[model samples]
Target: MLTKTKAYALKGLEGQAVEIEVDLTPGVPAMEMVGLPDAVVKESKDRVRSAIINSGFDYPIKRITINFAPAETKKEGAIFDLPVAIGILSAYDQIPTNCQDGYVLLGELSLDGSLRKINGLMAILISGLQNGYKKYIVPKENQAEASFVDGIEVYPASNLSEVVNHLSNVSPIPRLETKKFNGKNETSKYGVDFADVKGQLKAKRALEIAVAGGHNVLMVGPPGAGKTMLAKCVLTIMPDLSFEEAVEVTKIHSVAGVLDASQGIVTSRPFRSPHHSITVPALIGGDRRAKPGEVSLAHNGVLFLDEVPEYGRTVLDSLRQPLEDGVVTISRVLQTVEYPACFTLIGSMNPCPCGNYGSKNKECTCSPSQIRNYIGRISGPFLDRIDIQIEVDGISFGEFKDKASGEPSEKIRERVVKVREIERERFKGSKTRTNSEMTNEDIKKYCEVDRESQNLLELSFAKLGLSARAGFRILRVARTIADLEGSDSIKVEHIAEAIQYRSLDKKYWK
Candidate 1:
């Protein structure tokens, strides 16, 4: 007898349909799974066998051959355990096969037949729905993740016996109701607030512009100048992610297995702060399995790199492609995976190795050669991609002890949301979400500068010897500044502030 059940195999963030076909033939008692399965899929046979007997079902003594088709792609993960077990049981005439259609089965069966949650359940469920499969049988623990997908009947089962009971029409398991996820209430609110930072009005203004334009920023200052704190606070001031953006960000986290299972959907903009010692592959996304790296995990949010120059040259340089293309494509020998990396890069570094090179209260001990070499770790091309560069100074003792609080993130966020709305209206019917994503054509179309601003920009271009990419980045920043003030055209002051940000590169690099 032969039976077939539907399942899915994940390749990167997408899912490919896999049909689990089982054949029960009269021979020596043995089991085999074919079709390019990895070690985990092959080992499912033992799990399924033990689960079937423990669940009060007879393990067929016939030779059972299970095949996962299409026969070319390699299957990984234990998600195929349930479908494979069902296929074998149906082949032996223990359960009906008609119930398998229009349903996708995925779960890891334990030795005692209890269903265990598996990673990438959301992506698989979305893929199944996209492919016209509306019914899903997943582990009960994964019911929350699967419920995020609307228009689907998600039936979660606790053990193999429950699934069999449902299929046999003896007891029908209730389908889970889709609940509207409230990200605002579920998001964490314990992080650093903008009001906590004592004083750095200049740095605060630069961050507002950066968030408004979706531009990358770099801050240079000594330690304890609130660089890290300011970076953390930026999350609160930035505009919230749209529903589509949240889904994209959540999918990457899901694939990377970093998502919180209890939080069904990601609500807040992601903030990823990887250490400076992270590898090139870890920053850009590459490994044996081609898992998502920090950049991908920061999709539609921020990628904060503190002590930026401490990172290896190769690691910092790897960010150029994803910074420009808004995606990272990692090509392995077996497959090519594309991860969405549309994130705002916020990097912080000291002026020199001693971190007191430009401090008012401290004197630097590092030589010119050492300072040059230290900054040289960051390549010119990488530095050129950063849209805003500002130097932070330590707050005076008086400012630190001041009783007055700075502007709250809620106030800043309101202005940011307004600026984003303007950009949204400006870029309607287009792919871009902010001014930083604008191309040269977009600059010409939307970022038109008056005669005075053009003259000022030309002079700064000549004095700074800025590259054409740097020139465009300046225009993008200026446009964002103008947008923040509810201006339709870039003004001279906006261009001047943008030019001020560019001067830091020359100061540090020279």
Candidate 2:
């Protein structure tokens, strides 16, 4: 007799259907598995055999063969353990075969017949639901994560006996109800507020523009100049993620296995600060499994690279593709997987190796070549992608002593939310959500400049030697600036502010 059961395999973030087929014949006693099973899948035979016998089921001493259909596709992970065990039991008349239809099973089986939670269950459940699979049998631990998806009847089993008994109708298990996700907004209110910063109002303004537009920014300054503090404060002003964006970010983190089990949805935007010594593969995501990297983990959020010049050139440059395409593609011998990498890049660096190249009070200790080499580690192409580059100067003693509080982050966030609302209305029925994501077509259609602003941009472009890409970015930034001011069209002041941001590349890199 032969019995088949449905299962799933994860290929990167996506899921593929796998059919487990078990056969029992009257012959010599043995068990075999086929169909390109990896070491983990192939080793399921021992676990299945032990679990079946330990669970008080008749371990058939006859020739038993199991074949995973779609033999050409490579199946990995221990998620197949439960399905293989159930298939063998059903084939041997331990459970009814008709009971397994219209359901997908995924879980790792312990030797004692206990079910263990497997990684990537959320992605598998979402894929199954999208493919019209209404029923799922998962480990008990994954119940909350799997319940996040609606319109599915989930059965969380703890052991092989419970599953077998439930399927056989000897003891029926109740279907797990879909968790009611209230879909309420849970934005954070406590964080580093911009009002705490003493001075450097210019840098604060630049950060506001960056946050409003979803633009990337780089801050250069001496130590203790509020560069790092300002970067931390930007999170307070960022717009809250929509439900769709939350889903996208949550899916990525779920696949990366970094999601907090208590909070199923990633409510607050992520802020990833990887170390300077991070490898290229670790930064961009590539191992034997090709998992999502830090950038993908920062999707719909921020990737702050502090001490930017200290990082390896290769590792820093590896972000170019994801920066431009909003997705990272990892090509391996077996497959190519693309992960979302759309994120706001906020970076900080010292003026020189000694951190005081152009300081007003301190004398620089590093030589000219040292300064050049330190800044040269970052490539021009990467710098060009950054929309705003501001030099953060040290606050004077008197300014630091001032007791008057500056504008609070809540006030600034209100403006940012309003600006984002303008963008949302402008890009209605389109894919663009922020100024940074606007294409050349969008710039021409929506980011048009007046005669005075056009002349200012052209002269600045000639003097700055800006590329077409930079020019478009400037237009986008100018558009964002105008939106922040509640202006309908780009003005000369907006162009000037946008041009000021491009000065750092000329002052440092040129």
Candidate 3:
């Protein structure tokens, strides 16, 4: 007898269909699993056998060959355990063969006839729906994650016996209900806000611009200047993530297995602050299985690197590709995977070794060579990717003791949301959601400046010794600055404000 069941295999966030074929022939009673399965998939046979017997089902004593069709690609994970077990029972007269049609089964079967939750359930279901399959059988523990995806009927089962009972028409599980996402309602309120921070109005403005346009920022300041505190507030001023953006961000976290199963979705934008001691592979993504790194995990959100210079030179430089390309490709001999890495980078570093190289009150202790070596740790090419570079000086005790907050994050967020609406309408059909993502063609079409702004940019270019890339970055930032004030054209004041952000490198990098 022969039976076939439907399953799925995941490569990155994409789902490929796999047909599990079960053949029961008259020979020595043994089972074999083919089609390039890894360690976890190979171990499912023992689990299947024990689960079937424990669930009060007689194990088939025949030469059973479980062949995962399309035997070319390698399959990983234990997500195929349920389908393989179902195929064996259906091959015999125990379960009806016609019952498993049109449904994609995904679960890891335990030794005692229970089903366990597997990783990447959300991606698998999305891929299944994309491949024209609507019905799914997933673990009960993944019910919350499965509830968010609409247009499908997902039946959550707790054990192998429950799945067998459903297929046998003895009992059936209820379909999962779709949950509506209201980012405003679901968004977690942050404890710290812009109101809590003391001073540094210029730094606050720079952060607002960065968040408004999705640009990267670098803060060069001494210790106790609230660089870290200011970075946390970036999310507060930024608008909530739309439904489409939340799905993209959730897919990466689901595949990386870092998702909060109870929450079932990423309501707020991610703020990932990886330690400085992280390796290049861990930060950029690569291992035995090309998993998502910090950059990919921070997609549609912020990637905060506190004490950016404290990170290794190689690790810091690895961000160059993701920063420019908006994606990281991990290539191995077996296969390769690309993960999205579009994020706003917020980096902080000290001015020198003593953290007071340019302090006005404190006397300079580090020599010129020491200052050069300290700032030189960040390469020129790497620093070029950062669009905003501002120096945050220390504030006096009087500023900290003012007791009155200047501007609340809510007022700042209102302006940011309006700017985002402008960009969405400006680039309605394209992939760009902000001015910073403009290409040369986008720059030419949208960022044309008048004669006064043109002469100001030209003078800054020659006087500051700016590279061609640096000049274009200044133009992108200028476009964002103009958009903040609802200006239709890039004016002189916008260009001048953008120019000052580029001169901080000469102050320290030189």
Per-prediction TM-score to the true structure, in the order listed: 0.97, 0.94, 0.96
lDDT for each residue of candidate 3 in 77-179, tens digit (9 for 90 to 100) = 4788899989998997688866898889998888998888777777888888888899999999888888889988999999988998887879988788889
Following a full C-alpha superposition, what root-mean-square deviation does model 1 have from the true structure?
A: 1.6
Q: What 10-residue stretch in candidate 3 is worst by lDDT?
A: 181-190
lDDT of candidate 1 at residue 479, scale 0 to 100:
93
Off by over 4 Å in 3: 185-188
Candidate 2 residue pairs that clash = none
Model 2 residue-pair collision total: 0
Cα lDDT, all candidates = 0.86, 0.85, 0.86
- Which ranking of candidates, highest TM-score first? 1, 3, 2
lDDT of 1 by residue, 171-211 (tens): 99998988775544121474677788888999999999999
In model 3, how large is the Cα lDDT of residue 284?
92
